[model samples]
Target: MKTHALGRGAPQVTEFCLGTMTFGTQTDTADAHRQISMALEAGINFIDTAEAYPVNPISAETAGDTEAIIGEWNAANPGRRGEYVLATKVAGEGLGAIRDGAPISRATILEAVEASLRRLQTDHIDLYQLHWPNRGSYHFRQNWSFDPSGQSRADTMAHMEEVLVTIDELVTAGKIGHFGLSNESAWGTAQWLRMAEDKGLPRVVSIQNEYSLLARLFDTDLAELCVNEEVGLMAFSPLAAGLLTGKYQGGAVPDGSRMAINGNLGGRVSPRVWDAVDAYAGIAQAHGLDLTQMSLAWCKTRPFMGSILFGASSVTQLEHILNGLDLTLSDEVVAEIDAAHKAHPMPY
Candidate 1:
């Protein structure tokens, strides 16, 4: 697999970032470790997780279990600790299990970093991200009625300053290599970047937002912001939580599948989504492609792409996606995809 330059101050990582959100729940520790080893063998050098993971049914008890599993892998593979780029996020406010649903504070920054470091069993994190803003985000299918009229610029900037100062301190202390964002808008991302530059703080290197055949919200203002500012987009859910796989074509949820586990796949299921999936699946079959491979390959073709983030509960699924990493789409294939997007813009 080929590598891409991550942002201005970030490291070069593999095109595909192995996401481990299913660890300790849908996937056992042994299966997760095997997947990690397989991903490394296939040239993937990026692994992304969060403290509030294993989220098909996120609970207080299961929280941080994913990172613990990775920490075990790190403990066992001491020599290969630096082989890949390690990334994790500090869960923002409103998560009841962490910090009593409080916003990320100066103190919580240190607290979360220490816990993540302990769970990951690594001396440093290559990328540390704010999972979401304290001001609330329009992501996670919230765009339908997302409103920002209640936001106060002054308060938002104040929080950003506080976090930026803390992150700068962390960077200086070598606890984290870089800072990134998730579930953020273009304006929100620009605010962080601008504040970092004007205040001489650490730069925002990446934005791990949802981008896939079903979710192209990042293609508009976010794309321009990313390309101009040199912030690479670590696209999560490149398959739209398995919607792009065409497995749920006719409301037939396979046993033990994501939909079977969560029932709604985070509200990704709908008649229009199925229609969009059918269109894309037909296009893939027409081009002699598996929808999974086609979806992953198309993500790599985006101009503002940093790395495509995907999760797999089994090594079989990981291998299936890895099989498509090197597959390139033709001009016609891309054109049809764009046409489909225009027809079914936001199914969810």
Candidate 2:
């Protein structure tokens, strides 16, 4: 488990972050703890979760259950909180169970942070992220027809300012250490940086967007923005929701998989997506590497990647992923990936 500075002078965190979205759903508490223990033993000192976890079928009943599991682990393992860089997100708008589906305003941010802190059983969050922008996002297959022409820039900036002030308050109160953005656009990140600069609020240190060999949407503008601004990219779903793993190859949706619960893989399992996955799988096979490792290694090669967040329903799967932390792709392999990308670009 290689460690990198999250930002200049920021705490060093593992390059591979253990994702706990399945803690209360596909994974039981015992298995979740075992996985955490295994990851820590393997030298992975970063864990990422969310307020609305167990997300294959995110429901009101299971909301916050994942965080509660982590909280329990933290309580059970006293004095271990400082051992890892814990990151979690506060769901933005339209979570009917939380705050009656309200957008994250200053008041709502205060409430959300308090609720998250209680659920996480921790006083300070290493990285707290906005799950998504209040308006909307191009993530989750919404990029095809994403239109931002009609959005109110002034209103968006005002709302961001309000959230930043609340974040400043939270920082002062020792509720959160650093702030981050997720499912956000370059414009949104720019607004955050500008407001934080002018108002002397907290500047974002990371952006947790989906980035994988199959999902290269962040390779262009987000990559450049992160490189120039020093905001690290905490890439989620570097395997494209397991698509790049070749587990669902040939349309085989294995039983008890995320695809089994949500067959489309969150609108990711398209016909063209399989073609792309197979191509990459072939590349990995030719290199005598697991497709999962090849994909994760490709993500680490990116200029702005801070850490890659990967979740596993079982310890066996996690062990395989952990083995790839030191797996670096050669230029020949990268060229093969580029060729594959050009052949099957934007399959999802």
Candidate 3:
């Protein structure tokens, strides 16, 4: 696996980042640990998890279980902690399980970081991300109804400065190495960079947003911002939540799949989505490529991609992706993908 600089001064991370959202729930502790080991063996040096993880069915009971599971591996493997770059997120507002649904503020970030450190069993986090913007976001299929007219520019700038100050304090105290954002917009990210530059605060290193053949919202504006401003993209849901894996085709929900738990695949199910999957799957078949690997490989080809985050419920699934990490698409195949995307835009 090739490595890329996460941001201006951040550590180098593998193109493929092992995502551990299903660590404690769908996957047991032993299996989760095995996945981590497998990823390391495959030369993957980046791992991402969140405090509000195990999220096929997020709950208060298993809120921090995923981080604890990773912490267990860190505890057991004492000397190999530096083998990989570890990243985790602090949950934003509207999640009842964390901080009683409080918005992300100075106090909330400090509190969340300390708790994340305790659960992760690490003194310093490589990349600490805000799970979502406090004001709200257009991600998670919220763009269709998203409106920013209600937002106050003054309040938003104030919140950004406050968060940046807190992040500065964290870096000074050696709690986090770098800061990032998730589920954010181009405008929001630009303001963060502007504030950091003007105020001499620590600039954001990356943004974790959904980016795949099925979800290309980041391609236009955010893509330009990332490439120009040096903010790398940690693309999540690169497989379109398993839709690109050809698992949910023909309305066949496997017994233990994500579709089984969340029937709509987090609002990704629609008439056009199935057709889009078929088109991409056909492109993979014609080129004799595994769709899962093809989808991931395509993500790596993007200019702003720092790392592509992919999760698996089992070790076997993880192996399938690892075995084909070297797959690269041809020019013809990429053109076909682009054409298919134009034909079936925003399926969800």
Candidate 4:
């Protein structure tokens, strides 16, 4: 796996970040452990998870179970904690399991960090992220209905300042190495950057947004901002919820797969999305590339990509993804992908 700077002055991480949202829920503890070992053995040293994980049926019952699984791996690994750069997120408001769906405030940040530390079995998080903006975000197929017109500028600024200051405290106290955002917009990220600079608070190190062959919303303005501001883009759902894997090309959902677990891939499988997947799959076949690898490698081609987070329900699935880590997409393949994208833009 290739290494890249996480963000400005942040730790270096593998270009591929292992995603663990399936832990504890879709996957059991032993399986999760094996997956971790496989990823680390393959030189992927960056892992990302969320406090409200064990997803595919996120519930109050499995609320921090994913982190707990990692903690168990740490407990068994003994002193190998520093081998990988661990990253996790604090669930945003409306996740009643976490702080009763309260808005993110100074108190919430402090509380969430302590809880995450315990479940992760580590003293500090390498990259602490806000799972979603408190003001709401356009991710998770929410773009069509997202509206910020009702938001108050003063209130938003106040909230950002307070959160930044609290994150600054976490940085100073060694609870977290750096702060990041997930499912955020370009404007929201720019505001955070401006606030951090103006208030001398810690700047955001990364933004975990949904970006794949089917989801290119980040290509225009956010990509430019992330590149110029030194904030890395941590892309999640790189396969468009298994659509790019080609296993679901004919509406076939393998048992225990993400699609089989969460119907419609969290509503990502729109009317036009399947056609887009087939086009990309055709390109992969034409170029002798695995669809999954082609999709992941294409993500790395973006100038602003910090890392691509991929999840696996089984060891075989993980191994399949790791096979693409060393691939470098050629200019011809990239051009074909671009052409296919133009023909079928914004499937989701």
Candidate 5:
């Protein structure tokens, strides 16, 4: 496994970031612990979780269970917290279970940070992120007809200032180390950067967005913003929520899969997505490779990627995913993937 610099002054993180969204619900506590231990032993020093986790069927009851699971691991294995880079997010608007769908504000951010610290059992979070913009984001398959013209600029700016003030307070209080963003647009990210610079607030160190063979929406503006702004991209779902793994090929939806629980994968289910998967799967087989490894390894080689964020419900799945760290894609494989992208783009 290789390591990459987080920010100009931040610590170096492993190329692959272990995502723990399924830690409590899809995966049992024992299985989650095993996966975490395996990831660490495999040289993965970055772990990403959220305050509102276990999200296959996100509910109010199991909301913070994932963080608690990680907290338990950290507590059991004392003196190991400083060895790994911990990243988690504060839930944004639209999650009914959190703050009753209220938008993130100064007070809400304070409340969220305190709860996350309690759940994680950590004195400080390496990277604290806004799960989504309060002004509404085009992420989570909302770009089809998403509109933000209804949002008032005054309200949005006020919200950003309020949250930044609270974030500065948290940083001063030693509760959070750095700030980041997720599910944010280029303009929204720019606004945060501008405000942070003008007010001397904490600059965002990373942005976690959905990036994979099937989804490249971040390639245009976000990529440029990330490079020039030095905000690394913590790419989530680098396999398109298992679509690129060929597990759901030939219409065989496995039992106890993510699709079985959510059925639509946040509206990612579609016919074109299957077509794209088949094309990639054929290429992987031709190269004597597994699609999972090919997909994850390709993410590591991207210039804009800081860490590839992926999750597994079982120890076997974690091993299978971590194996990708050793498999590097050739120029021919990259060309084939690009050709396939030209043939089938944005399936979901």
Candidate 6:
């Protein structure tokens, strides 16, 4: 495994970040703990979770269970916490289970960080992220119907400033080490960086947007922004929610899989999505490569990639992905992938 600098001053993290979104729901505590140990043994030093995680079904009861599972591991190990950079998020608006769907504010952020700290059983968080912009986001398959006209610029800036002020306070108090964003647009990210620079507040260190062969919303303006501004991209769903693995091809949904749990796989299933998967799978077969490894390996080749985040329901799956950590795609394969993208752009 290789390491990359998260931001200008943040710690170096492995190129592959272990995602624990299913730690409590799809994955049990014992398996989750084993996965953590396995990831560490394999040289992965970055782990990402969210307060509103274990989200196969995403209910209030199991919302913080994932962090608690991780906390249990932290409590047991007690001494190896320093080996990894732990990152979590403060849920933005529209999650009714948390804060009654309230938008992110200074007060909400304070409350969320406290809860996350307690759940993670850690004194400090390496990276604290705003899960999404308060105004709204175009990610999560919302680009089809996204409308930014309803957002007020003055309100948005005010919210950003208030959050920055809170982040500065958190850093001063040693509650969080750095700040980041998720599901944010290029303009929103630039504004955060601009405000941080102008007011001498904490700089935005990273952005964890959805990036993969199927989901390329981050390729245009956001790609340029990350490359120029040094804000690393923690790409989530690097496998397109398992579509790249070809398990869900031909409408065959395996039992206990993400698709079996949630039929749409978060709006990723469509007529064209299967076709796109077939094209990519064909390319993988032609090159005699595992589709999963090929997809993840391609993510590493991007110049702006900081780390590719992946989640597994079982240790077997994790080991399979870990085995391919060193797989590198040749230029010809990458060229073919680009051509496939041009043909089946935005399949979902």
Q: What's each prediction's TM-score?
A: 0.98, 0.97, 0.99, 0.98, 0.98, 0.99
Clashing pairs in 4: none
User: Ten consecutive residues with minimal summed lDDT in candidate 4?
Assistant: 92-101
Residues 176-228, model 2: lDDT tens digits: 98899899888788889889899988888999999888788898888888899
lDDT of 5 by residue, 1-348 (tens): 778787545569988899999999999999998888899999999999998898888888899999999999999889989889999988868677877777888877888888988989888998899997888888888899999889999998998888888888888998888888899999999999999999998888889999999999998999998888888899999988878878787777888888888787778888788888898999999999999999988886677788889999788898888776789899999999999999998888
Per-candidate total of colliding backbone pairs: 0, 0, 0, 0, 0, 0
Better of 2 and 5 by TM-score: 5
Write one digit per residue (lDDT tens) for candidate 3, span 192-251: 999999999999999999999999999999999999998999999999889999999987
For model 6, how does the per-residue alpha-carbon lDDT over 90-150 read when each residue is reduced to its tens digit?
A: 9878566766778999889999999999999999999999987899888888999999999
**Best lDDT among the predictions, by candidate number:** 6
> What lDDT does the true structure give each of the candidates?
0.91, 0.87, 0.92, 0.90, 0.88, 0.93
Model 1 scores a TM of 0.98
Off by over 4 Å in 5: none
Q: Residue 341: error of model 4 in Å?
A: 0.3
Q: Kindly report which residue stretches of model 3 are placed more than 4 angstroms away from their true locations once superposed.
A: none
Query: Runs in model 4 with CA error above 4 Å?
Result: 94-97
| Model 5: lDDT of residue 233 | 90
Pull out the clashing pairs in model 5.
none
Candidate 2 weakest lDDT stretch, 10 residues? 92-101
Give the Cα error of residue 263 in candidate 1, in Å.
Answer: 1.4
